[model samples]
Target: MQADSDPVTSGMIRRLLRLVLGSKGYDLPFKSDTDRNFLLLLVALMSFLAVLACAGTLTLHAMTQRWSSGLENKITIEVKAETPNGEILSPESVKLDTEKIAGMLEGNLAIKSYQVMNEVEIKKLVSPWIGEDFSFDEIPMPGLIAVELSAATPETLETLTQKVLSVAPSARIETHREWLQDILRFVKTLQGLAFLVAMIVVVTTITAISSGVRSRMAIYRNQVEILHLIGAPDPYIARQFQWHAVIVSLLGSVIGTAAGLAVATLIFHLSGKDETALIPEIGLNYGQIAAFIILPLLACLISGTTARFTVLRTLSQMP
Candidate 1:
């Protein structure tokens, strides 16, 4: 019902005609729209993509929250087998450096606690790569310290770095936040891509609806011309397109959404409920479930509106 004149008033008037026509008043043979099934297939595929994209966006959003909180206010110290002056040190030196780092942590009021992982733990970490029997006595192994802080501010991190460097300049201090930052950025990029795909789905659905409307109009041109000859308003003709499009789109959307969620549920179960799964138990909440349910209904409304506008425009151009 868009117009060279007022769009709102014209839309209202067209809708009034549609209401007056009800479901029974049409001069055109509704069965003559040969592209109906094709349009439904296209709409169904687009709606499926829309649902998956939304689910991905929501899942990644949840991952961001879980991952960020994991590293909050935490840091790690890697005590390598090196001296303050960048010289390789003996295993004894590395252990002494680790002990010094631990002592520093114990004395610092800002640190809540720290654990210097034993040689057995270090050996266990390396065993998967170099074999279980690999002896650390042959090569000086790096030490690790897990530190928990009461509060980790810029000044606190700076002070901790200085203290570690004083003991062993080669020691590496990690707040464990760099990896988390990279993960968050990657997740954000994925979320953006999902949103972009959803928008593409919307545009594609509208395009499909428009194509169906025009194709039907072309196939029934003689009947439409006779209606024009009889002095029927364009709105009266447009309602036929509007309701048919709505019914077709509604059916497509329901099929697509149900299929999409079914696939999602299958994948979710395959991902396993492993408590150790990095992504957490990825499942839709009530809100997300409701959104999927609402998506098909929205498709109905959009297709109907697109059909109305396409008719008004196409009929105005016809002789």
Candidate 2:
């Protein structure tokens, strides 16, 4: 029983080694495993760039969503009118109009809370942009309401807008929807750019990998010629080169991706506590990180396959 168990354990150990480290079939002219290591380095660099490209796009989307949602529950009401003589309206009449509009809005069910901004509040907002001295008293400014909407149906802003219009025909409703739409448009453009960047990275990476494998094969021409003379099949020779490229690519991808995540983490930590910048920092979040890990393996597989085909096709055409 002990003898049998020893053989079985040895066999299991051998299988495990092969699975993790790959089979050492041929010792090439290049220093021990240099070819595979270089392939991996190439893969890692390209994949790292790919992750950077992906992160940029995702962060932009997250930031846009955050901003849009932040303003999702708030709206502004402005009250203003042109005088009949094509001049600015009287402040007293505007104030009166603002009161009537506020009173009407206060009775609405969709409104969660309402605050009528006095001259002071309006001036406070305008101070930074224009100047502190800017006042509603000096300039015929519109009366504004800072409105918070009910959680159930914030989109029903149209109904509330109509109600305000009924009370004061000249009243204006600015729900931030247009601004949100503009933000969304900007986000969409960013997403488009991200997609384009991702595509370019993939194409460039694939090309780099294919070229590297081809170059490595060219160096191994003499060995391949000897193997062919010794009656080794084309498939066998292809398999060795393919496996070497695959191993290298796989290892490189793993290293590059890990570095990418680490850099993202460092940036996230250094973002300062402002919290207002709202940068969409990177995190794995379980399945998300796993997806990135899987990508490297896929890249390796693709690179290996390309190398295999390129070598076999080239060999087939030769005498």
Query: Model 1 over residues 247-319: C-alpha lDDT tens digits?
Result: 6677778888988888877777777667656577787777787889888988888899999999999999976
Write the residue-wise lDDT of candidate 2 on 115-232 in tens digits.
9998888887777678986556678878888888875254586677778888887888787778679878978887898788778767776677677657776887888888888887
Error of 2 at 25 (Å): 4.3
Which 10 consecutive positions of candidate 1 have the poorest summed lDDT?
A: 1-10
Q: List the residue pairs that clash in candidate 1.
A: none
The number of clashing residue pairs in each candidate reads 0, 1
C-alpha-based local distance difference test score of model 1: 0.80
In model 1, the runs with Cα more than 4 Å from the true position are 1-27, 84-92, 107-109, 120-124, 228-232, 273-281
State the weakest 10-residue window (summed lDDT) of model 2: 1-10
* Model 1 residue-pair collision total: 0
